[model samples]
Target: MAATIGDRENAQDSVRSRKTNVSESTMFTQLKTREPKAQENSSTRSFVLLALIFIGALVTLGIVYLNFPKLEEHEKQYIRLPRDIEDAKKLGNILSLYKEKYFYQVLGGVFITYIFLQSFAIPGSIFLSILSGFLFPFPLALFLVCLCSATGASFCYLLSYLVGRRLVQKYIPDRVADWQSHVNRHKEHLLNYLIFLRITPFLPNWFINIASPVIDVPLLPFFIGTFVGVAPPSFVAIQAGTTLHQLTSSGDAVSSTSIIILAILAVLSLLPVLFKKKLGAKFD
Candidate 1:
């Protein structure tokens, strides 16, 4: 009787152990199955978000295309004046009319639009600066143009940081490679390099804004360099705009004295960077 009871107890214990093992194994399998599904769901959501962004971009481009005026016809009509200077004057006149009619509303809209265009590296910004000068007094125009330009450029820098090298390489491959090498060599003194690039006529402003992000330039240096670097040119263009009526032709738009002044200003802007570089080389 005792042996039978002991055998029965042993059988019960074995059954309980097996049941526990089965329960644990079932739970683990369920967890494993659910984990992958969750991950796949997350990945799908990301892909959908990316697709929506791409679709939105396409729609925006289509709208821009539809709204854009036929430039060829305008070019033919204004063959006498240089296209850029002519366009600048026309745009200035339009903006001036809007300012007269709508006052604050027009000013606000222009400010917002200027920031957007500069941030995106869109064309016609130089013309817009010129227009500002033509429409407003010199000091006010300088303030507005410089502030908007700096704000817009900072936005571009942030964009470059987010998109990284992959986007730059894919879209602007040649420029990316060239800028990357230049930036890399000066990465240690990024601020000076940026200042030099901004003040000098070595590269286009749009190119500087676009490539700055891909090369991991810090925001402080980028913003400071842009703000200071753009001021001289902005002032020069704005002053030119004040005399827009005198510009019978594009040749008359920029005077020899103005060009010389601009050239000197450009060199003056580079002095700080050159001094710093020389000091570093001597120490090294």
Candidate 2:
């Protein structure tokens, strides 16, 4: 009788094991079927986004042609950076010719260029910043640069949040995890942290712009911090525009004064964290 009961128990265990295996097998099959479709969809969306950005750039150039044909030479020259003092002088001469008519169009061109370079994560925005100084005065240039930087980064934030976030998790899980923990700790002071992020160059701006939303950063802080944080650097670039012609090298623009200012701002951003820690200690 004991042997008979042991055989019955063994049969029940075998049935349960078979059922578990079948369920797991079905789940694996489902995952295999879904993954390719998901990747294809993600790829399609990324391509569409790139297409739209390039289209916008083309439209901007078209607007310049339709409206300001006489400034054709100016348009082509202004399309990229003035390589040196002579180039700057020639472009300046063209711009001065119809400063009244070209004022709005010049701004439009700069605005579109800024958005294009920033949204696509292109590398030429530093040149654009310098160009802003070359064309517009300090205040106007600063405004345009900050506005475009903040807006462009915000778009990138949204883009990453929607599509790139999963890829980041899949590939750089450890690095993302570490950053997430650090970011989470300062969630309450996100704006300050963002300022610190913008002021310091340890992390590339493109990375911050792409990764911010993925890590659950709010948009307001991102925008405000970007607007305020980039001002110092923008100021340096625009100020250097006053002497764009005299500039022999790009490095000559970011003077020591500006670097020191940025450093001070970076240190100031950390003060809040330090203050909070010391206060907690005193209370304890």
Candidate 3:
């Protein structure tokens, strides 16, 4: 009778152990299911935050536009953001008329507008760069364009750093990974690599601005690289602006020679890395 009681007790213990195991497994499975939902919610929050910030920036730009000195009825039509060469030409002519009379207003307007477009990855900054040449002196135009590009690109970098990671990973995961690998290989000479990137068409400027921070590229290097790296190409655009009246199309700004020169500059940017590697090998 004692042996029968012992067997019944052992069976009860076995049943309790199975129940515990099933309960633990269900808990883990529930957690696993919850994790993805949590991530989705987080992504949704980030996207909403970005949209709100973008709207705020647009509102600020609108305020600037409103504050701009009043214009004649005829001038208003040409004052819209230039989307094409003709639009740029019309805008340039109008801005030039006011440039001498309202120097600060005109300069501040261009500076703010250029930055706004760049900070949001908006198009038409290229036309603005060209217009800079038309409206300002060579040295001033170059400086303004460089400063605007760096500042605006930096803002974009920060935006991406804050809330762009998930979006970038979601939309362009493969591209981000590829660029990250490239960035890792040039981690030691990142400034030069960045300059090379800016000089060439291998990556778009917007992509670099958005991806640099996501890949852990430092802001100082990114800013400096953008400021200096853009000089060569900006030179071409600003130069084109000088003859804005003569051009039939924006494509007229770039020639085969400009492309060749840019290619050479890109190659030169990598020379320092090549030299460093060679010296390291020699010392070893």
* 275: Cα error in model 2, Å: 3.4
lDDT of 3 by residue, 128-221 (tens): 9999999999999999999999999999999999988888988999999999999998899999999999999999999999998888999999
> By TM-score, how accurate is candidate 3?
0.95
Question: What TM-score would you give candidate 1 relative to the actual structure?
Answer: 0.64
Error of 3 at 42 (Å): 1.5
Candidate 3: regions farther than 4 A off: none
Error of 3 at 65 (Å): 1.1
Relative to the unseen true structure, what is the C-alpha lDDT of residue 43 in candidate 1, on a scale of 0 to 100?
Answer: 56
Ranking by TM-score: 3, 2, 1
Cα lDDT listed for each candidate: 0.70, 0.77, 0.93
lDDT (tens digit, per residue) of candidate 1 on 137-162:
78988888888888888876665555
Q: Mind sharing the TM-score for model 2?
A: 0.80
Enumerate residue pairs that collide in model 3: none
Residue 158, candidate 1: C-alpha displacement in angstroms: 2.6
RMSD of each: 9.5, 3.9, 1.5
**Among all candidates shown, the one with the greatest TM-score:** 3
lDDT comparison, 1 vs 3, better candidate: 3
Residue 269, candidate 3: C-alpha displacement in angstroms = 1.3
lDDT of residue 231 for candidate 1: 77
Model 1 CA deviation exceeding 4 Å by range:
1-84, 98-102, 248-253, 277-284
